[model samples]
Target: MSKIDSSLFMSPVKQIVIGNIRKDTTIEDLKDCFSQLIKKHDVSFRIAVDKKGKQKGFAAVSIPITLVNDFLNYNGRNMKGHRITVVLSEDFKISKSTRWQQEETGVFKTPSPNQYNSLRSMPFLYKLFDAGVYLTHPKFSKNALNVIERAQSCGVKKMVVLGANVHQCEQALGLCRLFSGSLFCTAGLGPKHAPFWTDEAETQLTQIASSGHCVAIGECGLDLSTDELSSSQSQQLYAFEKQIQLSIKLKKPLVVIEKQAHIETLSLLQKYKDQLVDVVVSFVPENKAQIVKYVQEGFYIYIHGNVFLPQNSCIKKWLTDSDEETNVPFDRLLLGSAAPYHSVFRCTDIDWYPRQFTDDTQHKSFDIMLKHCKDNYSEPCSLPSMLVMMCCMVGDRFTPRSLAEKLTQNAVTFFHLDKSVGEEASVKVTGEKFCNKTPASHHRRWSFFVVTALVVVAAVVLLGVVCVKYSVLDKVGALYNLL
Candidate 1:
């Protein structure tokens, strides 16, 4: 076979030939040895014997070129009871025809000003995996798959599917299995889905908790936005109590979804403080006082891009404040796009809609919000200092990246997720991807029409006023002559 330069090799393809296998060495033993060697070399390889009957002692192993040199350097000198010879298989070549290309050339397109603005404001938002997403909808199988795909494209790999039912939870588990490295599922009740806990629900949750797939118990909490379901305060309270009890029993971190029920929610949480591990409150309190109260009480507030909405000035003020009474540092904050599909808000102009809450208005709102925090919050920290704090919270602090690591280090850990999955799921957009692409050179074609319409209206109004004035003046002049 013709020898090729190592630089020219790209595909992961290698072949190994073993000779003089010990009589006592079973195929299992050889396989085990080869597997160990493959792992040590950080390569994947397959083994096959040349013949069924006579060539039992001789076998051929195929591995990718990526691992060939390392494998040879490390394991070629030794094999099970025999030295091994490794060579490239001449017949083997990775076919280029099977290579798949993304049909959408610019699928990973740059975000609009609004999207970029949010990203830029939160400089510490290194990637998407920093925030842990809770998939809570019953129709999440399709939506979850899509969300994961989009997140992967955006460079986010870590995810937590909030399974609302046993079947849905199993489906989420299967997805987690497929995306083994960074995908995870949380088997719990959702406020809108299965908020109330039952015996069957308990059984399902217990099974999921032990099944080694679920990471947290939640999105089970109070949502006062709806009027049809548990919209009543009493019903919401009951549901919240049951789920909290379940979380305590299961010893899992609580992934809370709070809405307009802050006072009651906080009260219940504090009441059951011993049972709770980690609490993530989303899109509930709109002002700094509420956020401060939660932080002072020891709750993790999950901030989505939506906190920057124009309507949320109070929220922004709270975000920007630094004083003990007003400010909660960004390190305590978690960044969430809440993208792909869920409707907390809508932006008609942007092609890509972030499902959670990040909109242009929200982005601007957050900027203003942080500014307010910096200006009014106790001791003034420079913008850089504030930026650093934001980074600490969203990038290395309260997020899954930091929190996951901390949980790993802590002896009394409640949340269990595959660290690798969190690492993989977190995605960072390139600067180019965040650049503004609006064509500013294009003037509004209707400008002239608007101008003409305004001029005509002004002329008409002027004529009417003149007519009224002339009529009054004529009457006055006539009266003066008579006098």
Candidate 2:
């Protein structure tokens, strides 16, 4: 199928910040003024307001970057008898707080095991629960259900299951259904998964898209991270274009995953920018320039636990060194763990999770449901810890609460995840109900021991008392006692 041309929508969209907004400036009044000035009815407008239902003397309007020149020609124009100063939104920083955490020099310290044990009792635990976390790109795995279960217990109320290949796309579809409305997914071949791409791949994706099983169409894009291309750069590019076309055709957002191929991927996306609902840059790239480029392009950036890894130090450096013109806008940022089971819980230092407890008392439960969760390929963080870190210690671009809330709302607005959790059950958990849902870890361990003991007894009885001596049996008994 022929695709849309880049010239049609390649023009960037910039947010126009209007300060000294009149207190009486209603949304309709501002919208009417922009609609009249631009001679278009579709301009997006919003006014910043404080908690007391009062206007904050500022508002923003989103319009085509091409029209920014025309819009600025009227910069000092009067509206509602108040002259408004219009300019492109400043490169947003966590400028609101001088003492906030710096991604560069700030140390990211994971809470100790004892700290984890006390989480159930900490007053901050309720805050974490209420803030809620959104996982924008959790890859579906064999232990998908277990991961989902643990994520819910950890206060991740919603997530997007990213489909990397055909198999995973199908698995993600099942997960979306299994979780009912709590999970959504993307359907496409990522660069790594595109090695086997074929016409059938697009066909499958089309069907998945038509079924409304996917909110975005990706985990797809270009990647030139390695010394040589995975299949051929051409093949990855072809697969990317196909998925982009599918996203545009379906009019869904695109979950973009570009590593070393940012320029090429962004160039491809420019073609369908008009039709695409949201363009999310999936992970933090090592190159700061790429991040600046994406932010300038007005694409939403998805950050994962990888940001905390030492190997990803460049990402941290970018946030620190960026000035007013290049800072990442908080409104355009979103959080996702590329693979929640493996990538979600990540930090530079300690890897620990809150102790599981029983229903009535604070007695620690020993059941390790996700034993394989320990062999993490990324910095480990529980979903709750990741949310806490993002709010309190990740960046200085915005106040902790504001940045955290903006990122959460970004995910909701971008991917269109459920937002009822915000109003209905923001912080409803009261006590141990948070940790008691899963089975006890110690009981599971003892069950394994009991089964092993039965097998050992059976072996002894069948050995005719000749394979080993009674002294060996005494040693075995002693070892069992030690256990």
Candidate 3:
């Protein structure tokens, strides 16, 4: 597959912002102008309106991405007695918010614990769809269902399970099946496991990835952070390259993990730039220089709890440092976490969330939740909680609501996850009963899940016994005390 040119992918969204618009311009008037340009009926044309029902002097048009250039050529063209300025919505940070969440595609959750069963987030505006979580890590996988259930209770609509090897991939698929609407996964071997990559493992990887439940490939990339990898760099390269090939063959995007080997990872991704789908650089803790490189390369940055990106004027600087001619849009960011709120420092300056997102009762609930987490030894880094914290970290008196929505939108666009949650239940925009097709589609997975169901049940039973014997279930109550 020929890689799509980086230049061509400059705008990830299909919409464009048309400035200097005439107040008299109607949707049909603008549609008539661009009608001969794009044929998709789904193409939407709208004029921004104020609360007073007056036009906001600009209009927006959403069309297929391939036809973006055709529309860009309309920049500075005469329309409605004015010279309109046309720029891709990708060029603007807050403009990426989509109506996909409002679409009535069945808001699809059947009644179960998988629903937003017990969460404080029901009162909040933006529900969490955590795109990248290391679900197979012992921190989560040992008591996977209970942990996932806790996350759901925090109003997490979707989770992208990360698998570093074939065994992890199988386990990830099992979890995805168990929590059908609420989970998706990625399959790949990270740099640490590079030495374990064998021909048989590669074959197994390819087979497991064919499960259709996978949304992306990898957490795989080069990591020369340790002397251990310094010796087996060749093996790491071989593993990363093979996963890249697998990603291309499978047409799945990549979730690249880079640690110290930044340039090497960047070089390999660039080498296969065209043959690859989108790339998300994740789990790499470094400075703005590393982030600027990935952002410039048109890749998405996966943000986890361990790192605080909004401080040190990072978000403000990115906005001002960029321009239309050579824009390095900060819209290229994603959210994920490996462990639920472990090792993260609590910044006293930051509030639990923006004061506006909650009501009086919800605020009181949050206060109770915060005090509870502090009293208990357990952590409170659930995705929804982390997302709220992310808002505060960035909310230095700017568009915090839009910023949070944009972060959620990035995950939805990356994994193609659904966008909406309902009253007490969570459903995607497509009106389907489940967010994903393969897991809930018994036609495709009945036998596969039947075998795994007993194992999962046994594991839960054993987990219950261990919790009782050790009195661990008491602390488990603190986990979802976010309510």
Which lDDT tens digits does candidate 1 get at residues 1-483? 334334422232334444455534444555576574566453322232222222234334445444555545543456555765544333332211122111234121222111211222232222333244434343332234334433443333344555555555665565555455455667666666654556776786667665555666766677777676544566557756777887778777777777777877788999998668777677646666777788777776765444544565555566445555565544355544443222223322122222223434334333432343321121111111222233333433254234323322221122433232332432222322322233332234467678899999999999889979789668878999999
By the TM-score metric, which is better: model 1 or model 3?
Answer: 3
In order, the Cα lDDT scores of the candidates are 0.48, 0.57, 0.62
Where model 3 places Cα greater than 4 Å from the true spot, the runs are 1-121, 283-285, 309-330, 341-381, 393-400, 418-483
Q: Tens digit of lDDT per residue, candidate 2, span 1-483?
A: 112122222233445667676887776777667775667535656655544445567666666544666666667888888887776554221112112111233332222111111222221232112111223233222234345545454444556767778766765665554344456667888888777889887898788766554667878888888866754789898888888888888877887877777678888887777777778886557577878887877788766666756677666666556476776577787666444433433454323323321222111111222332343532112544445445444445555345545655676677654433211222223223323234354578899999999999998787847536556777878899999
lDDT leader:
3
C-alpha lDDT of candidate 1 relative to the true structure: 0.48
lDDT, candidate 1, at 115: 20
How far is 129's C-alpha from truth in model 1 (Å)? 1.5
RMSD of each: 25.5, 28.1, 27.6
What is candidate 3's lDDT per residue for 198-301, written digit by digit as tens? 99988888876776567888879988888988788999999999999999998888989887888788899999999987899874445557667778788987
Task: State the weakest 10-residue window (summed lDDT) of model 1.
Answer: 375-384
